[model samples]
Target: MTSDRVPVVVAARRTPIATKGARLAHVTAEHLAAPVIRACVDDARAATGARADIGDVVLGNCMGPGGNIARLAALAAGIDVAVPGMTVDRQCGSGLSAIITAGEAIRAGDDRLQLAGGVESASTAPTRTFAGIAYFRAPFAPSGFPDPEMGPAAQALALRYDIDRHQQDNYAARSHQLAYDAHRLGRFDEEIVAIGDVRVDDGPRAGIPAMLGRFAPLFAPADGELNGTVTAGNSCRISDGAAAVAMVPAGSRGTTPGLALVAAATVGCDPALPGIGPVAAITRALADAGVTLADVAAFEIVEAFAAQTLAVLHLLGLAPDGVADPRVCAQGGALALGHPWGASGAVSVVRLFSRLVRGNAPAGTLGIATAAVGGGMGVAALFKVVR
Candidate 1:
């Protein structure tokens, strides 16, 4: 939207996503991000025909070491030491927030070649404890509201939205199938780089249809009446991965831009149902971009949980059967790829870029990346491919 300098994504790439405590357990977040960042810079140079002197790098991270992981990653990637780097945190929204910030900076003429993305090392991140009193993953609410873990919140959201266990199971099965098919077809090859021995996403198991209705209730007690639909089979598993995208002004170095960051929005909602948060953010982002949902050719809604994904789609009047909708995560999503916390949102951005620029979609197509965050928040970004 800026008249001075338009923000565009020239290239994008990501490391092979591995399940937590699996293949990536021994790799640090910085190590995982370093090579991907370097590869992305190389990709951007190829796309834009730019000199290698890229500008600042920004990365999103959560539960990593205390220092600025971005700086370390830049150094490890052998990027110019003078090119500064920083890290931002917005919990689950961290990655997309970093991308939005980079685009805004580009629009503001802050830098010519900027690298922005997110990295998470859930496998290596240290566990925290309150003096051995309790171990917690995260809280959905702050304090006053009835805060719950993500599983319970998703279950509650499903009940409120009238989505049943059967529907969630079907969605899960669909996710695995789509992911399996995409992998077999090598749809993800353009974006994925092998990290150590992991050549592809280590999540997404085949044969979901046979096990659909067999997952035990996760959030309900044995005698309880609650029919919780959120289960490990249908929810995103914690994973380790890193992803990066290069941003440059539209006219910089004659770059044939793959996507333009048209608009972005981050909104807060009732923490009681964090899964529904993306609804408001997506609406706002579309409004900001001066477009309607009908204009969007592709959609990437973070699949934190099957119930959450279904709830957001239903609330927005979009088809809850996103798997059947070619425009919505047609290549599979977080449920199958696994969620690397801070990196997942950036992964969505990367997916949009690949779908558009990898000759899989037509030019000028619009895409949206949206996510439901922990502690009652959502983030959405709009993009359009331009040759």
Candidate 2:
């Protein structure tokens, strides 16, 4: 029996990665989320030309106080108090999860209009709330579990994948080239929302290899046994940003005939190798979509680190050397465009949408966005442009 597929359409999209915003050395977390929500809501309303009431707000934020960030952001955006809001956490995949949750709600016929997205402010990373807890007093136990830090897990993946520091540096360089090319061609301008004076992703550099050479290994200690290939140069940088997307039922008014989420998959992995989670999630998403790696025209793999991306590519049989089609982030990946944790997944969605629209690729052009989470969790979503 053929199962009915519920359509979740993008009614609006917005991101705040302004050049001026990046120049600010620091900004309060609350301040960051507030303006972003307003900008996104305004854009969504304009795009749809329908001022529909938002039925729900789902936000993803990894580092925040008490997990009420979504509610706070919604309130700050002047959303009606009657609208319910909830915050979620899935490490780096939190943003994508937020979008997925909203879409699922719509698919289930639970709500008509939903606001979903993610935000991060590394400039104001909250201190660990329970540093004095008993968990910290325990002696180190070696069950092969590395520190809970995401970077260390990425380093472990580098070791497992046999990726080298030089290769990582090269990948980072390419990310810069691609990001720069996209910016020059005004590809990002579509989804980018100007806030104050900031416009476009302020952190993407032009030449990443030269920048990588200036940095040292971030996770591996100089004197310790070489643990892995992950490096600051190859991994995403700390950043502050926010992204939001408005979703409605397929037949909803003001729906854009663009990309739509085809399938979403989330998977668990050995916490020791958090970076590899994307491979499992991506595989599931591909299977559900009844497609293969060869069917995609471009990929927007979140570059949490070069090692992690390389590993996922190998698993999908689409490693850089293996596939001939150009990946959207062809210029550079997260290594060049600072990854803002919860915000990165949403950023990937925006980037993918822009590429498909500008390139005018076939409606079948598939795009995938994946992210590695703390504790070996990964999430992926497949999207296809609507003909």
Q: What lDDT would candidate 2 get against the real structure?
A: 0.70
Pairs clashing within candidate 2: 18-199, 174-331, 175-331, 175-332, 177-331, 178-331, 179-331
Highest-TM-score candidate: 1
Question: lDDT winner among the candidates?
Answer: 1
Give candidate 1's whole-model lDDT: 0.83
Compared with the true structure, all predictions reach lDDT values of 0.83, 0.70
Stretches > 4 Å off in candidate 2: 1-26, 131-148, 219-228, 253-255, 320-325
The worst-scoring run of ten residues by lDDT in candidate 2 lies at 133-142
Question: For each candidate, what TM-score against the reference?
Answer: 0.94, 0.87
Q: Count clashing pairs, candidate 1.
A: 0
Could you give candidate 1's per-residue lDDT for residues 1-387 as a string of tens digits? 454477788888899888889899999999999988998889888876667467788898988875899999999999988999989888777888888888888777765688998999998887767767655464555568866678888888777777778888888887888788988988899899788778889866787667867778788622366656678888888999999899888767474767888889999998878888899999999998789988998898878899888888887877544433567787888889899988888999998887787855666799999888888899999998887
**Residue 121 lDDT in candidate 2:** 74
Candidate 1's displacement at residue 360, Å, is 4.3
